[model samples]
Target: MTTQRPETERQAPVRVFWAPGCSSCLRTKEFLKKRGIAFVSVNVKDDTGAREQLLALGARSVPIVARGERFVYAQSNADIVGFLGLEETAAEMLPPAVLVERLDRVLHAAARYLKQVPEAELDVVFNDFFAPRALAQHAFRVAEAFVEATETGEDYTYERMMRGTHDVGPGDDILGYGASVIAALDAWWQHCPDRSCSAPLRAYWGVQSRHELLERAAWHSAQHTRQLQSIVEHFGGLPDGPLGERELAGLPLPDSVWMEASADA
Candidate 1:
């Protein structure tokens, strides 16, 4: 006779059979947190029934995510990404072929901005243009929304980003910029090989022109650059030039320019 896995055990990580205070469990928790996926962590030692569940699932190890009859041992970022269907979204949202192409234009523009701004004036410019923490939070929120919408078969709307409702001050410029960058990232993800499931997202973006999207991304980056400058000015000069290489490397650019480049191909 087959042993039945309890209802709670059937839930998810699907069943995070872990030992309490285990280092692996902690790492697994961190990974899930980073991806924004909610999971119930069951400590095998505390929950006696969970051990039976693990045994039935054929997992001798402490850290395992059981899904019904099948189970995945330990926490593998790739496994989690696969189990959660992250690749489909990556393919649909950001095709591997077009990745570098989209990134290049944005980086070039950032490089140019770095050259134009003086070291002493960087801080003031950045603060006046954008708030770093706020922007980072917004990006995180957007990413969470995308992940949720993708998983639940729902459409993630950015009406605030598009309509400029989130703009804090000065003619809704910052909100507009934020919306544009989100749009660009959405576009890149749509074309990616792993994110093909983001077709709905791609279709949603299709309504807007590449030029319009890129303009918003560029504007957003420019504002962010200005904000960085403000930081430098206030702090009495930055140690590393103006913007770090990593920051410049990740700037969002126009898709039209991306499409024309050989790098994406």
Candidate 2:
């Protein structure tokens, strides 16, 4: 059955397809509620037709949200922040430049790591996480999108590559792979004149307001650095040393503060 928004709800139109007991779905609901944006929530399992409609949207995950014609599947904190244009509010929560920078560092490190290890060992690493064909495809997609997005200033086509695939082995390894992808993007960005460090950097902040973009960008970048460390541990095993505590301390503000601010708001 199709669900229509009430007259009041139509004033701030959003439609959220959710499944009960999904944490992401609840988070999406709460995020919208907090922003005072009116939304129509459809429990996909309760309605057969709604489930089909969701499938038609190319969404296979819970907490799929649509605002007018723009839709994002598999709601994430970043996705929600970007969609709602809450960069100003969430700016303190993330370091914007961190994503690109961390991406740069990790990709280079992985490449170096691969060089140090033998082909057989690399094969073992690939085998541990992904099929041979799948690993090659993923690497190629990451490299290609980094080039395309940098050259054209378009959205990275990485999302398209990830479609139809759900189990990315372990979450940690997937994140490490993501770091590698970001690294490729950074390299491409550095070479492309059309791509300013500032533009894609803004994505990390999720800010609609231009005035505070840079500050937010830096914070967003720093946050991703921490996340990348976690991803490394998931894939390559924990670091033998202290794992760069000084780097974290040097960041403008701790993630704790930004998280609290987002939560409080």
Candidate 3:
């Protein structure tokens, strides 16, 4: 006989695929238990069916978190930390207006950091595929797609965003493009403040909502902020930031969705 959770506890669907001796798996379990959140636990090591299920879900690792149909195979406990929704100062706790304002500030800060990069280094490749222009263009595109999804309630696909704009470049107006991106994000949060208001996300990304997008936008720019700092370091330029040493060292990095999107790429 199976026991059912109280209706209130059943509202949010959460599951964990875990294995013994996996610290992250243990942390995820403890995280849910401490928060009074009801969740299904699957021990992939002890249960054959559980292992099969994890593989079927495209997870090769333990400590996979599933919020409804969305799955995050974490490299560290910090990667899935946003799902807690409990931190008082977290973006999820911010009022809609403030949240939108924060995105604008991040965009402006990124533009400022980009401007500090030497003109000659703009064309220098930092990683395998990203440079200053590619990174800025990506942020602009992501904001643009999210804004459209907010307005139309239609799922925005990567293919669709690339169709007409594939050949378009950022030109020499990186800051100007960033302003438009920030404006669109502001409009999105203003019109869609209710955390429950959700539209379909592109299946390729995962099942997601406006709430998830907001969290993503916050983390996304932070990732670029780190990258920009690296670029500054390479160019022997000082990257300015408000974060202190310990806080900067402890910054939580988002799980790279690029790994999951590789098949599509």
Candidate 4:
């Protein structure tokens, strides 16, 4: 007889699994709080064996919503609503063309901020998972990953986005990567036959239209760019062209710089 894993419990009280420097995690956390849904939040970034628990539950990334052993990737607000039985409608999204413009502004701003980071601070870990330099790189990577999805039509996996957080050093090298991603985004749009981006693509959270994902890409990177601006201030240097309300007008960004104060809430 073959041994089998136990059945997953689907109706249990909610448990949220998350890590630092994750945009989706922050969004999911905020959404739940705004809805007044009580949940136990677990920070896998600084906790021992918490990551192992996620692996056991078959989740390959952070921002996982678990009910006992059954978990869903909390990447899409719509998916979270369906999984938790919430009555909600998807928010009206900005057009892909507008989102592209927003992404351009965010990426350029992030590149400028990253180029100012000192080499000495490259390895300094802000939390257990990410460094000061990695934060800026992550901001760029989130946008790059979205473009990668458009080009490859593949599921936006966590590993693909976080793969290079440690590979590049501070300053020029990171800026180069961001420049490449910006170029790629422009090229893809110029050549794309459909500006609407109506085709659906598989993302870790749920199946979302290319247009929907574009908005995600724009706001996702913007959130990290906001964090990068704060880090620039921490290093006693003013960030060039810091994003303000005009740049961040429509993005659904959270106020907290890092993860929320209470990861256990």
Instruction: Report the C-alpha lDDT of model 4 over 1-265, residue by residue, as the tens digit.
Output: 0123344544467889987667778888889999999898788877788899899999888789988767778877777887776788867777788888889899899888776766687657754446657777787888888888888888877677777877755453676777898998889888988799999988876678898888878888888887777777888988898797667877766666577434656
Top candidate when judged by TM-score against the true structure:
4
State the lDDT of candidate 1 residue by residue for 1-265, as single tens digits. Answer: 1145566644634556666433335445555555676666676766658788878877666556556566665433344455544543321223322333433333343334433445343222232223333332233233334434444445434443323223433322333444454554566556545432324432132332232233233334433344434444555555244444433333332112111111110
lDDT of 2 by residue, 1-265 (tens): 0245445533456788876433346556666776687777777767569788787767666667776545665324556665655554443422434434533443444333323333343333331233322333343344434445445545433254343233333222433554555655666556645323344521221222221332322233334333333334546555333225333433333333112111211
All candidates in order of TM-score, best leading:
4, 3, 2, 1
Off by over 4 Å in 1: 1-13, 88-265
- Candidate 3 residue runs with Cα over 4 Å from true position: 1-95, 160-172, 191-203, 240-265
Off by over 4 Å in 4: 1-11, 127-129, 170-172, 260-262
Tens digits of lDDT, candidate 3, 1-265:
0134455543666778876533345445665565676777777766668878887777666678765445776433334555444453422334434445555665666777788888876755555435676566555665566677667767755454433333435455767877887777766666665645454454234456565555445545555655666677778887766323322222233333121111110
Q: Candidate 1, residue 156: CA error in Å?
A: 44
CA lDDT scores, all candidates in order = 0.42, 0.45, 0.56, 0.78
Candidate 1, poorest ten consecutive residues by summed lDDT: 256-265
**lDDT winner between candidates 1 and 3:** 3
Give me candidate 4's TM-score against the actual structure.
0.86
Higher-ranked by lDDT: 1 or 2: 2
Task: For candidate 3, give the lDDT.
Answer: 0.56
Give me the runs in candidate 2 sitting further than 4 Å from their true place.
1-51, 56-63, 66-99, 108-144, 152-155, 158-160, 163-187, 198-237, 240-265
Candidate 2: 10-residue stretch with minimal lDDT: 256-265
Winner of 1 and 4 under TM-score:
4
| TM-score of every model versus the real structure | 0.29, 0.41, 0.54, 0.86
